[model samples]
Target: MMRGVMNRKVPKEILDLFEKYMDNKVRHLNRKDAIHMLRAEFGLDEEQASTMFDTFDKDKNGQMSIWEFQQFYVCMGTQPSNPHSSAQEVVQKFKDIDADGSGKIDVNEAKEGLKTLKTATGRDLDPKEIEFFIETTADDDGQIDLGAFTNLLYRLKLYNAPPPPKDVKLKNPKKD
Candidate 1:
């Protein structure tokens, strides 16, 4: 949710990529061109690439500028410049948390899911906050469908945070 920090620094590599593929002198990448670049350069499938383009298009105007890309990396967290994931991966995460094969997550299930997320991400979310998230996303009957859950995760960047760097304590250790 951190947006519009004027002094934030964007990595040169990111800027280079944008500069390389810029379609116009204005240096802005429209949605179609960005999608093509993402698919070609990053090997992302169309859906995955489109998702990333949508994320960076902050103004929701089908165009992405260098500044928007910088803000996206900021929102995605430092160190891991790009945390985009395929829709399949996101669907898997939703299925993992849904439990009981119900295709929907109830309030109680959301609590358990929140605990699992905390364990996985080391993020501490209060039970009430988790409940509120579920309540707000759920239907009048109080059950969140898979689509809603996926959208929530996408917006929150829950499934997009890269794993912590692993410290290789013993370089070239014997293979098992």
Candidate 2:
């Protein structure tokens, strides 16, 4: 088994590998670059690399900045191993939801995606709650970007976050 990379400082070689695949223009790694690095350097299969991308996509933007990558490395070092659309599947679903190919899931597409996915919450999600969930994931213009939607799907399948209580009102929930 591969050791938890974060158990100690991330090795220099791994750090070098990150740079080896990183996009110099943006100084970050997109989904493809990250997956390539994970596979080439760590011998992760496609599913594993995709899952790690979800874990590492702190902002849910489908991209990993240097700080996000390092922070993920540090956190990974500290966590216990636990037991996904597999990871690429979640990503593909996100792409499918991006019907217009704008690389983002607009409100209309999000509604459609809600249909494709089974309700993660044990109880059937009410339309209002579904509306709220999409609302929360949306940007100011009311669109769910690929990162936001992918992370949501990942969380739904993996973490199973509970829907908020009906009586509760979030005055200002944090985004990203």
Top candidate, metric TM-score = 1
Which digits, one per residue and each the tens of the lDDT, describe model 1 over residues 1-176?
12223225546666666666785555578888888876765555776567667756778889888788665444433243443444345546666877887867777777787666542355655555465456656777778665466445644555334333344222212223
User: Any idea what lDDT model 2 has?
Assistant: 0.61
lDDT of each: 0.60, 0.61
Q: TM-score for every candidate vs. truth?
A: 0.51, 0.50
Report per-prediction Cα RMSD to one decimal.
13.3, 8.1
Mark the regions of model 1 whose C-alpha exceeds 4 Å error after superposition.
1-9, 41-43, 77-112, 119-124, 132-176
Model 1 residue 149 CA deviation in Å: 8.6
The residue pairs that clash in candidate 1, if any, are: none
lDDT of 1 at 107: 73
lDDT of 2 by residue, 81-103 (tens): 21022334455777788888886
